[model samples]
Target: MTDEHRSGCPINLSLEVFGDKWSLLILRDMIFGAQRHFRDLQKGSQEGIASNILASRLKHLVELGMLTKRPDPAHKQKAIYSLTEASIQLVPVMAALGSWGLRWQPASEELSIRAQLLEEGGPELWNRFMAELRDEHLGIPAEPSADGKLVRERLQEAYLAVLAERGKSLPSKA
Candidate 1:
């Protein structure tokens, strides 16, 4: 990473951190799919990211402070990746991008359901989801919800419902 930046604009600065084609998608997999290992991320990506690209992006994201990588205690040769606070704060941005994609892009219904809920739920949902992400990733406690179900669970349920409606099999989380 170099100190040289094209411009001082916020968008430009943010893009410098994650402007590449693969960075945000890697973050998306970590956030939505809970993929913490290199193999999981490489295998789970719908776009089928190549191993070298995945490795390079992971290093870049960690260097940018958007993610953390630590040795996994469970496996001797494996490392676990986790989203950092900076990346967790991108929920709204992700929501807005999803909303735009859903509006203008040809998106699959089952794949786009979470974005739909996030769009409809608006800031309220985004805040709650961010709180959840903070709790999960940063060890910050989020206030208890009235309904008790996790925000992710609700999103997953909606996703499953869409898959069921389409008669598609559930994709393995592994």
Candidate 2:
């Protein structure tokens, strides 16, 4: 981070703010995936970060105008967080990075499912999904889910099952 930069490059500034590994993960959680609170981000990430690191990253992101925090009506003491337009606009960046990871970096078949979902679904699906996330996070109108249409829940269930299997099938995976 100490590497000096003189001129003003937008990309350079972006990387300076969110170029690190964990910051993007936080964005991924909020925008593409389901994450609202501190605990959710920590539990869902594969690269386990300490509690202090997670707190610092959250604070950094808030300061960067990528996220906003609001008081939870139900829980007076706790704050429920959501993404700003700046962060939600990172959908393309998220899509590109996911595609890049699947291409160059070999992740598990299960891990690749998320990438596949975004890649195969294209922009329309991604936009709709992000719209739903925006609605939920912003405390706006939320679309009602079908009786049994559990998309993320199903994926998470499968991921948990994969964890329980624990190297039984994915010997080549990281």
Number of clashes recorded per candidate: 0, 0
Per-residue C-alpha lDDT of model 1 across residues 53-103, encoded as one tens digit per residue: 999999999998999999999999999998998998888999999999999
Per-model C-alpha RMSD: 2.1, 5.0
Stretches of candidate 2 off by over 4 Å are 1-6, 140-174
Best by lDDT: 1
Error of 1 at 159 (Å): 0.9
| TM-score (C-alpha) between model 1 and the true structure | 0.93
lDDT of 2 by residue, 1-174 (tens): 345654478898889778888998888876645778777777767677677988998898898888888787988776777888788778767877888999999787777767767777778656666666667666555465565443456446666567666754432212
lDDT for residue 47 in candidate 1, whole number 0-100: 86
TM-score of every candidate: 0.93, 0.76
